[model samples]
Structures are given as structure tokens and as C-alpha cells.
Target: MNRFDAIIIGAGPAGLTTALVLAQAGKEVVVLERGEYPGSKNMFGGVLYSKGLHELIPHFWDKAPVERPVARWVISALDKEASFSLDYKNARYTEAPYNAFTVLRSKFDSWYARQAEAAGATLLTETIVEDFIYDQQRVVGVKTGREDGELYADVVVAADGVNSLAARKGVIKKDLSPDDVSLGVKEILAMPAESINRAFSLTGNEGAAYTFVGAATQGIPGGGFIYTNKDKLSIGIVVKLSSLSKTGRRPEDLLEDFKQHPMIWPLIKEGEIREYLAHLIPEGGQTSSKSLYKGGLLATGDAGGFTLSTGFRVEGANLAIMSGMAAAETIKRSSRSRDFSEKGLSIYPDLLRQYGVLADMEKFRHAPNFLKNPRLYQSYPELVCQISNALFSVEPGPKKGIGEMVKEARKGKQLSRFEIIKDIYAGWRGLA
Candidate 1:
């Protein structure tokens, strides 16, 4: 058995960051990964938020394989034949501390893992951590799929993704429910650079991201996204697991339907689909997982249910990096004191709270359910898109003002004014 000051499971962004931070602090750290390489099996929607990430590796964009810096964000209200988009851009974002950027997880994770290695941490690929090596009730180490299998550590940071078995070993009290989890399926489509630039109205390293809600998922409690990469497009759908399964719809079928939407069809007209991937993520916040830390162990990234999927945005990678950094800082402090127990590991969870990560998730806990409304996921988008189409169709209808048309559209939906007010009130309260 090999011994180390700390052992981290999963070499994705979270684990790698944690290892790098702790190792740089002069604590011995080893990261065990199940993939052939760090990012070989990873996938994401492609946007990286700046706030949490920049705190981990200052000026990361200088060395990272970032595809494009996002300059504009658009949310499209969609239907089968039409769509409406609300876009926002700022010149201030063109400079440092930029809002967000696009990334290919496979490329990004490998780069991040290498950073950890450069910081004096050992990274083990193709090594799966099977279970915790427990002493009494405290987790003191792990058993691996490697030869001779066992390794000891003072603490463990389980930065594995959403369906983490590390958290399943009785540390956390409850199992996640279908309603709290989302199944996301994505495809990366390659298109010629010129074609993409012309299609998206781009000049240089600027990117566009669009989120489609309503009539896009065939009435599922979720939506679709199209993220522009340098030479490809990352497009996909994320739906509540329970809702999809109950409706008896395959994610691929849903993707096909999404792609067929009149507003979506023209956007990807001739691009060739290059890759397909799916992952389960935590949609509902605190109620989604039972534990974030336990005896001699700390959980970071998706393992702690940190992904926040508010209807308009998804912020997982940023949160993962932040949590990993916090865990490492906690471990560093614990190492100095030589107290690696449940009470000691409790510091990691406390640090997460102090970092406002847990607090933000708690504050937005209502956002996910408020998003579950079928009207918001279906009829509303159609309403908005139809309104935009009507306003721009260049056909002869009664020349009504935008205000009159908006009133009529609201009344036409057989929706009560009270309900609209309530939804607006709830959405604002949950997400604002």
C-alpha cells in the first residue's frame, strides 16, 4: 500500500484543482482517475463562468485551450416554426475578468490535470477507486482497481461527478431522487469555420450561446441549448430524469425533435454531427444530495450536487473549481494542525458555506421547481415566438401596437393574470 498526505478520486477539473492547490501548499497529494486520461471521458455544455474559475488559476485563459470568449448571450423562446431571442452584450466583457468562455472538456481537463502534475502532485490514470479504506467509522484511505489495490491517506476528496459512489458509502444519509436529477445529452457538430462565422455573425474569437425553452422538448420539464465553439457547435437537451422516463421518450428521440424545430433546423442545416454524449446532473439543489463531507473525507464538484441550472444558465464547472479550491485550502489548514478526522474534515463543508457556494445553492433552491412548470417549458416559448413572428411576419393582419398584441397574446393563452403574476413573482424570487 502506498501512503500519501492526501488522496483525491476523480481527475476531472475538481480533483485536479484540489490536488494542485494542496500540493502547491506543500502537502503530498495524489489524484486517481478512472478515465484513460484526465478528460478522455468527460463532456459539458462548453461555457466556463469566470468568477469561480479565475480564482483557482489566475489568468487561465492565457494558457488554457479556451475556444472563444463569449461576448453575447441569447435566450430564445421557441416553437415548432418560429423563435424569439433576447440578447445582451457588453464591451466591458471584452477585457480581463471576462464573463465566460467556451471549452471542450476533453481538452480542458487534460490541461488542468497537467497543471496539477506541474505543481508537484502525482496523477494516476486508469485507476479507479473502488471503496474507502475505513478504520472504525473514519475513512482513512481507498482501495483501487490497481495492482495490490490499497493506498492510505489522511483524507480523501471525492471530486467525482454527479453519480458518485464515494458519497454512497453511508456518509450521506439519503439517495438522490429522479426529480432532482437531469439527464443531458449533447452532440458536437463540426462545420467549416467560414460557414459558422457567416451563420453566427462572428468576427473573431467571440462566441454566441442560445438557450431554447418551450415547445422544444416536446413538453418535457427542460429545454435545449446551442453553444458555439471555434469550429463546431455544442447542442443538446437536458430534461428531468423522472419526467423523461415517465413520458417514455428516449433522449436521442428528443434531440431529434429539438433539431427538427423550425427555429433550430436552419441553425444546424448542413453541419455534420461529430460526437454524442450524455451525463446525469443535479438539478434540484440541497434536496438532491445527502452529504457534502464526512469523516476524513470531503466531496467536491458534482459529487456535492453543486451544479446550478437556473432556466437561463448552468454553472457547474465554475462551482466545481471553486469547491475544489476550498476543499484544498481546508486540507492545507488541517494538515498544518495534523487533525484529519470527521471534525477536521468538517472544515471543508464549513469553507464551502463560507465561500457562498452552498448559500447560493440554498438561495436558488426554488429556481429548479419554478422551472418545472409546463407552461414555462412549453406554451410560453411558443407564445413569445409567435408574437415575434407576428410582429415581423410582414403580412397584413390588423395593425395592432406591440402593447395591444402583448395583451391579446396573454389573454389568448387561457392563462389567468394571477398565474402570470405568480410565475413572475416566483421566478424572480427564486432566481433574481
Candidate 2:
């Protein structure tokens, strides 16, 4: 029976961060990863925000396997043949303390786990945590698949991603609902750095992140994204699982359609597919599981439902890091009193709030439901493209004003003034 001060399940960002913090504080910690290596099963849409990660590893970009600093952000609305985009680029974003950087999880997570290992945290790869070892009503440790593999810990941190086995074992959180999750399918397209820079108008290590709605997903209640890496492009489509099922549309097919789009094809033309990955993303927002801790156990990251999606951006890694820090702090506080019970670990939520994990989730609590409105994904994007086409076309004898173009765009679209106003109000309340 091996024993430690704390045991963290999964070797992803959250679990590794927890291990790193605990190990740095001179506390005995072990991280169990079920994959062949730390990041063998992990995948994410490229961008990793700097603030939360910096708190864990100061100036991490100096040595971390970061692809590029994202200098341009584009949100494009695509109709069948037309597109309208809001593009913003800032030179400062390419400098130190960058806003965010494109990263490949397989490379980044392995590096992060090494940081924890360097800090003296034991990492056990290809180790599956089958179930929680319980002491009556409280969790005491985890039971692995190995012979005599019941490892004990004062506290167990479940960072096992969205489909957390520990969380599902009737303790930390409930099973995720299909309606609350999205299926994200991505591909890494290998290309020359020069080709990437030329295509995206980037310089040096500067990159671009583009998000598309409307025809990108074929009006599915979701969107598509592309992130520029050093010499590869990460492209994918994330669609609500429930909506996808209703349409009987395969995510792979949707991704292929996105790549074939006239607007997207040119950028990724001649690129070779390097890798394909898929994962489930939580979009439950405010309605997501809030129960982060229980007796002798604490859940962090996707296991705790800490991901945030607010239409404009989807954040997970940073929130995962923040939640991991909060979990480590809670365990440290509990150690003072030697109380790992639910009440002792009650401070986890407050710590999460202080870290802005809960605060941001709360701020956009209405966003999930707000985003579910079909009009935003389908009607609104088409309307924007139509309006753009009307404004840009020069062959017309009589040019229409912006207001007239908008009216004309809505005329055959079945959208009424009242419905548009209602959507505007909903957007303000849900996302603002």
C-alpha cells in the first residue's frame, strides 16, 4: 500500500498543476495518468491564455513548447457564398506576457508534467484509477488497476477531464448531460512556417486565431475554428452534441465541409494532415456542476465543470490551471487542521471564486442557453453576409443605405424587427 499526502488523477494541466504546487510546497504528491504518457489522450483548440498559467509557472513561454503568440483574432460569419468578418490585430500581443499562445496539448502537457516531476511529484503513467477507496462515507484514496495497487492519500484530487470516473462514482459531481456537452473534432495540418505567415499575414512567431459561424457548421448549433501554429494549422468544428444528434450529422463530415469552404480552403490549401483529435467540451455554463468538493476529495478542471464558453471565446486550460491552484490551496489549508472532510474542504468554492474561475462562469451563466438560440448560428450570420453583399456590390444603379440593406436582408429571412430586438436584448444580458 503506497501512501502520499495527496494523489491527483490525470496528468493534464489541472492535475499537473496541482501536483506541481503541492510538490513545490514540500508536500508528498503523486499524479496518476492512464495514458501511455502524460498527454497521450488530451486535446484542445490551440490557444492557452497566459495569466493563469503564469501564476503556476512564471514566464513559462520562455521554455515551454508554445507554438506562437496569437497577434490576430478574427470572428467571421459565413453564408453559402459570402462572408463577413470582424478582424482585430495588435502588435503588442506578440510581445512578452502575451495575451495567449497557440499550443499543442500533446507537447505542452508532457512538458508541464515534467515541471511537476522536477518539483518532486511522482508521476505514474499508464496507471488507471478505477475507483475511489473509501473510508465509510469519506474518500481516502484511489484503487488502480495494478496488483495491490490501492494507493492511499490524505486527499484525492480528481482532474480526470469531463468524463471523470471519480466524479461519476457518486461523489464529487454528476455525469454530464449530452445537451450540456459539445463534440469538438480537430486536425493538425502541417505546412511551412513561411506559408503560414504569408497566408495569415503574420511575422516571426506571431499567429492568428480565426473563428467561424453560420455555414462553417452548416448552420449547426456550433462553430468552427482555426489556429496558426509554428508550421501547422489547428482547425476544427465544435457542435452541440444534442443538436448534432438531431441532425444525424457526423462531426467529421462537418469538419470536411468547413475545410472545403471557399473562404477556408485557400488558407489551408496544400497542407498535409498531421493529426486528428476529438474531445468533449462542457458548455453547461451556469448550470454546470458547482459541487467541487466532498469528504477527502476535490475535483478540478473539466471534472469539476470549470470550462467557460461565452460565444466570443472558449476557455479551458486557463480555468483548469486556476482551479488546480485553488484546489492545491484548499488542500494546504485543510492540512493545517488535518481536516480533509467536506466541511474542511468547503473553502474550495471560495478559492475558485477568488481565482475568478467561478466568477467568470457566473458572469456568463446565461451564455449557454443564450448561445443555443438557433438564430445566432444560422439566421444572424446569413443576415450579416447578405447585408455585406448588398453594401459591397457595385453593379446596382440605386445604392441602398445601411438601414435599407438590413431591412432587405431580413425581408425574406423571416426575421421580424421584434425578434431581432429581443435577440439583441438577450445577447446583452447573456454575454455582456
Highest-scoring model, lDDT: 2
Which candidate has the highest TM-score of all? 2
* 163-235 per-residue lDDT for model 1 (tens digits): 7766566565455789878889999999876777777777677787888887668778888988888899999
> Tens-digit lDDT track for model 2 on 51-145?
99987788999999999999999999999987899999999998888999999988899999999999999999999999899998899999999
Model 1, residue 55: C-alpha shift (Å): 2.2
Determine which window of 10 residues in candidate 1 has minimal summed lDDT: 283-292
Q: Rate the local accuracy (lDDT) of all candidates.
A: 0.82, 0.91
Which parts of model 1 have CA positions greater than 4 angstroms off?
287-290, 393-414
For model 2, the superposed segments whose C-alpha errors exceed 4 Å read: 287-290
Reference-based TM-score of each model? 0.94, 0.98
Worst window of 10 by summed lDDT in candidate 2: 282-291
